[model samples]
Target: MSAMVDTPAPAPHPVPRRTDGSSVPIGALVPLTRPGWVEAGRHLLAGIESGVRDVNDSGGILGRPVELVVRDTAADPRRAAAAVEELAALGVAAVAGEYHSVVARAAAARADALGLPFLCSSAVLDALTDRPTDWVARLAPAQSHGWRIYGEFLLGAGHRRIAVAAQQSVYWASGTRVLREHLAAHGGTVVEFDMDALTPSAVCDALVDHGATALLLLTGLPEPAVSIVRSVRGDRRLDGVMMGAPAGQPEFGTWAALLGEDGAGIPFLRYLPERLGPLGARVGTALRERLGEAPSFVAFEGYDTVAALADLLGTGEVGRERIAASWAGVAVEGTRGPIRFSRVPGIGVRQWAWPPVQVVDRDPAAPGRFRVLRTG
Candidate 1:
């Protein structure tokens, strides 16, 4: 009976390779549970996963696989800081991926304190990278740049009286401030409306009363933006009015689907064009397969973040200091275009100096499709 006890060799326990001597671990700090931003987080996560896969397929960094450690921040600044600290404790070589600008600020501070390389994926607040830290860099263009481009578009559209439906978030506040200041400089009258405090109908009424020729819907949440658009569409007084939003959910196909006919003729700033070059097209195709829609700007930034990390960590021990040093002059082709960072004053100190951006509107005839109106 004892001889018949042929217990198969205990299946080997798959030990977690904290460091494989070949595998590089990167942390993705995204807002997976944020009330209105979960979809954005999912798309960003998908892009990150796709980027890692591509890196490994092309003979991973230093001939080792890339591993991703994802953490949710719930779109909270404090939670974002905690997530970064935990990722650092887990010995992640670097950290990337944040959608909320406020959360990105907290995470960047923690990453700097931990001496870990943190490449911000999509947070656009100007303060996120205002000062150059050896440990922190950004892949997304600053909000100021995008706002300036938006201001130009509005001016070109002959929108002299603009009303802003702004959310109460720091990102929206700062973005609207820049936009307002820019428009004022150009002799355009600007007025702000609290999106949360007023109903969509009330906001539209106020816009009409104020003789606002354009309505800038800066609510970062898609639902509120859609409601406001619908309200405006119902009001004949707003006919022929130029309505637009900043680079938020309006760039997502899901938002267009929700808006349906209401989305037509509304313009938004988009970082990536619908059509991409070779590298961008490859990432776009993968994203479409995973997300069932074209990749949004956040998704493109996520993929670029991981690709940049792989380039910085190529064939070496993952050290934060080394990664920071190597990142200073490195340039890689990104989903949007060639990605590069530089020390620029007024904007982020070590941010993507110039990322491609464009203003796009939903195609009137083609549902869920966008047409590029202007490029930056």
Candidate 2:
């Protein structure tokens, strides 16, 4: 019998890997060209890119690096929805990043319908999270929580009568309603004004006439917030009145630069805590190096969103259901602090329940020195 030549064992096929060793594809939807949100979009993109770098540097998730696919939504709801569809078509494992609440709303709906996980980076409108979806979560605090914190700060500072200058929009309306309700329940009064209709001088006159000890600017636009600040500061009558702008927190430095000395002593609801941990410091430094400016709250949110997604994807399961289940119980240390999510009744179902937010006073002596006055 001829000795059968044993066939050499077939060589095992090498496991496939991406050129960069990345296995997960994530989409980032940002407003890169919109008039009001362009600068903010750049900042958020920087943070998200930095987060992706950090994740890869740390050996990546499950040994597979993450690839970021960027899409510009331009803060338009239709464009945002289209972007979501495009990302889905690209086969991205998840979608993240949106600066405008309107854009986020549209993007969230599309992502939900496609069964893609979406992590909202900075949109604060409370209604964004009103319905609990298996795939939607937010890293930023809701506007309701932000307004409640603002109310507490104003009331705590002994301001009985507050004047609010707000634009007519769903975002502003929701925030004002929360602020008004909170203040009214706490023996404080709110005098509202149409931000567009009233000139700076007229707003000051109304505040003076109403005997308002504080001014809460909720215009939801940085340019208007800066304009109001300038107007209020120009008039000596409103000099002693405390000024707070919950809408302008992300652009505090810009307002400070425009207001010069006037920006000092003004407080805003800062989503990022004044204090930073070791990881936070590293991310902040990286952001400053990349953006040539101090990181804003939105930047932190963007970074935290990517970090959370990395955590969720690292579990070796990549899909809407798997990510949702993993994310619902995720508690990772973020740039601000411990990041966690829970069902927020009357708000979003599963949202970042406890974002470490603070009321920061801008200091002219130190342009980026965020002095924490109150924390929540």
Candidate 3:
């Protein structure tokens, strides 16, 4: 994060508007480049595309075909905001899909200002808007809701002195706060180590010095997180300490691909049930074929975002008003379960209230198999 500087705005790019009445275009904001998690974006898009295919196959929504107008945010807030502006000008029925919490926050603010209905797919920051508005709704569980569950899991595991290796970001900071507050209330303590300021070995040394029984990696992937995990795992002094990633980093295949056996036994939160329902099983199979792998919970969020919208627009006019009204009026069977939005306290948008919450890890005996430890 650099200091803000005043600079002249660049000339606006001309956006081509929809000139034909062939299909209903919906805006998709995804991260397809660096700094954004491209793997997650691929899965999310696969699910949304799969949902769109299902919608069209079953005789399109309101008999009108659905079109996805995609713009890559690359995890940049400014880029996401610009995409929303362009989508609004293009006359999209609604805007949806975002994986980064900060980027989703920026897009949410822009959609609120432009009065475009937004169905957020994956980003789960609790307060998405500065104020409440009917223009925005979310499909994922709020950060506070999920992270508090993670805190409880840690306490149940008897980790009283927990340490976190963190970086500066609104999403990470919020998760840290949730853990700190929830754990403190239960006679547990949280120790903070700034990953940006210390090397991996230094973090391990500090964990030993502080007598922390557990260390949570609240940082980003592939660099500091991987390095820190390796350092701590190899340190003989910290052999008995547990490692965790409450943000669900290890839920993805890349974690096992990179860390192999070392990635096992580190618990993380995931929004999935113990067993998939009928719809979940069917969609999960389609998503696996579409993505060439198993789908993550983020992918299911994407599918549900579009599927719920299709349910709302049944045999009715497709416009901003109906989409906005879907916040309270629509009830659809999501891949996870029944999907509906309502007012949840402290969340500045319509929310699903919750998706399933689970604390899971890769099985130590079988690194590819995920073992569920607890569910909320």
Candidate 4:
């Protein structure tokens, strides 16, 4: 007597393909991050590698095998530039990946010097675009694009006096500026507060004295946002008004908990939904399967960069110049949406605008988990 058990077949791996029905190894460059960031970077790379394997197995880019080259920037600006140089020295047709904007700017500059096209996965600081580095392209849209959605959400909710909390980081500063400018255009006055400007006590006083009914937090790291909320809560001024965008790691539930009732009415902005849209879902699933976790918009950006390079390689010319030429109109289905680069360099060509304003919903099932109440 035998018990029959069905074993599932393994999923097909991605392969990079060349135009002539041959396989070529596509390479990538990853940044060195601190412990936490490194782990996240690994997740992003794993997803891209998985997609590469899948692409290879399914008849790859034009028909070449995809290969990944990893380097650690150690989260240091100088080291990041060196990493890019190393990747460039390897003669990788194009390079992709880097989460931090400062790191990206350095690496992008290096890639430009070497005549290599740089495609960054995260790096949303507007300064990344202002210089117009011909070597760069980005997967994620600028915070301005997403923050406008946050401002609109607040205005739509009947809030006119809004206070803005910005971080010292490049992305935070630029985004805060854009948010303030736009809010003014919409008849809302913004009282700006730099996270570095005030202590917890001073921030609490400012939030109350400023007469702001709505709070806009623009920063990459969650620490500042958490601190601001705590200050507001401790002062007994938390009247359930808070809003923010990707405070770095992409998880806001814990931050929401710290603020408690203050977080109840708080809504964090997200350009990409975790469940993902039709186009993003496929990329997300494939990425999760590879990374053993869900992919962030950052990781999706990495995938798109490689996809763009892969398309360029499919032209049958494998030099850096040919890659650059092909890059002009390069477009691919990214985890976020369709990605394309403008010839102007730093400005991302096509960005999907689906900034979902998720209000903190206390889940009964999880007890402390925050769920999304409204998304638009």
Candidate 5:
């Protein structure tokens, strides 16, 4: 009888309660970027918005409807930080946005101050992880990873001497620094050349003076980077040498004819091409149908950021405290690989690595179609 009386009471079971109790499911505030950026973001947001709607229509996030709160960050860090604070004011579950690393960092700082969870969609600067803050997370890979890929490929391809060309922009400069470090680590050397002078003539002159075996173009768009490639190739001064990085833009096809065989040595570090599947194709088609353009890395990042946050919100804890706790090791089967927050301080943001790709051939008639060469 005494032994039988020792049975412990059964633990209470969790009663399924609505996670959306007078609270919005999830919200996002994106900095209004350039026309191209805005269009790209719109495409990404379209897919993400559709996905979110699908979830809400099916039953919503824990029975709460999800909402997207978009604000114009104008691609400015100050405005971006303000945008996050404004979103916090809305009592949103989480805030995700901005493609620039600098801007994202600024927003992250603001989010941390407000004790909100942040997911930076496209910022890739490795400097982002210099300090570890809990509220900030990223969805792009580190600059070091991208640079390491470029450096490894160059070294492996027998190009021991490299020169990095950039437009004096922060992004390009950062890439140059990281690439140089990686190149040095691989027993290679990198000479940095400034492309900020804008004119093709001036850029060509600089490249001629700073001759190296290969060139890494770290500018944002294909046009600027391609222009430099064409100028250098046309002058015949940059012949035999290779060009690389962010040059992986599809516009390389258009420049291929101008570059002819010269472009063959050119390679670019495109992140997450593996994720460019049916979803990407569909989003691209829809973007073309509605906006008369296709999505780029910008759009893809935005879509991914929102899609991830919406799914997290669906799990029944939309508050920043709860979401942040879940985010540290939360893995999502993203268009990229498993995107999760690193438990490490500044490095805890989301990061992805993609196999490097080169343009083997460009469509003779198409503007942005290219055949992939040796993906690594």
Candidate 6:
């Protein structure tokens, strides 16, 4: 983790736009480069851009076309903080978009200090801010909210002994804690597997030694997780041991491309209903066209971020101060469901209270299809 700092250094160049005074610029912070989960960033940006088009097509925010001043955080905490400062300096009305939770925390802290209204698109770390502040709000369900549900699902499935293999991250650590706390209350226990200390085979052995009925990959993609999943699947020693990823790794195309059927049946958290409503279906169609594939829930989160902001920006006064002050009254039919913000207990910033949380997985028979295992 790089040290976070708040200085307005120019980040990546913005997407070319006109100076003709027809657009309203909103600063977008996305992880477009390595170490940042580029796949998720692409979906998030597509959803945001699609939402901008939708808002402009309907009637631009206050009848002005929205312009995105994009900055690639590249999964660095310091970079995200700097991007937020730069976006503020560039006179963006609000800041939005980030897939990584630690990066989002850096951006949130900077935005709070700078008095910028940030509607975080994704990133569900429970403590996004250290103290109460009116400048930041989030559209994603908090880690505790979603992970507790996942814990319940695990318990209901008759798994009392769970093993969590996690990378060294505040986000991952927070998720592990959530699961441990939730599971402990119901006579379930979480065994922590230090990712730095275990090889894929050792992980399987550890699972056998601990008698962990379920294994959760609280890790990053494409290296340890992918290799671990492959190892676990191939090891006949681990037959019938359920695999899980509450971080929602298998929701992306990259997972299937890398793991194929190996990624199947690994239930993960996603914030969408089992079925789409009219608005969700309409937006989903456009997002699918723009992304040229089925968009993930992160995409809807991006779209919902803009939709919520557009409603507030369109209906009333505009500025950082006004936007920050007006979070309590936000109500719009989001692509997921009706969006509303409130101060949740133990959560610092205004949160959507929750989006639809579901535990879904790729159908083992068909890797391209997802099966909704549980919904709440």
C-alpha TM-scores of all predictions: 0.91, 0.89, 0.93, 0.77, 0.78, 0.94
- Relative to the true structure, candidate 5 reaches a TM of 0.78
Ranking the candidates on lDDT from highest down gives 6, 3, 1, 2, 5, 4
Candidate 4, residues 236-270, lDDT tens digits: the string is 56655554443433343344345555454445544
Which structure is stronger by TM-score: 2 or 4? Answer: 2
Question: Regarding TM-score, does 1 or 2 come out ahead?
Answer: 1
**lDDT by residue for model 2 over 87-166, one digit each (tens)?**
88787878999998878988887776666788899888887733456668888888888779878988889997988888
Query: Model 3 — TM-score against the truth?
Result: 0.93
Model 1 regions lying over 4 Å from their true place: 1-22, 315-318
lDDT of each candidate versus the true structure: 0.79, 0.78, 0.86, 0.59, 0.60, 0.88
Model 5: CA > 4 A from native = 1-25, 31-40, 197-199, 220-226, 247-266, 273-294, 344-367, 374-376
lDDT of 5 by residue, 1-376 (tens): 1231233422221223454455453556554466334543454455456556555676666666666777766567777777777777766677776666666666766776666777777677765633455556767667666656666777777887777666665667777777778777778787766666556667667667766777677665555666776777787766676667553443323345455555554566555463366666665565456545544455556656765675665566534566666664565655444555555333645443432233233443543555454444
122 in model 5: Cα distance from truth in Å? 1.2
Clashing pairs in 5: 32-73, 131-346, 132-345, 132-346, 342-348, 355-376, 356-376
Q: Which lDDT tens digits does candidate 1 get at residues 152-208?
A: 989998887989998788788898788889989989988999977999999978987
**Runs off by more than 4 Å, candidate 4:** 1-32, 35-40, 129-134, 219-222, 246-265, 273-279, 289-293, 343-376
Question: What TM-score does model 6 achieve against the real structure?
Answer: 0.94
For model 3, the local distance difference test gives: 0.86
Give the candidate order by descending TM-score.
Answer: 6, 3, 1, 2, 5, 4
Task: Supply the TM-score for candidate 2.
Answer: 0.89
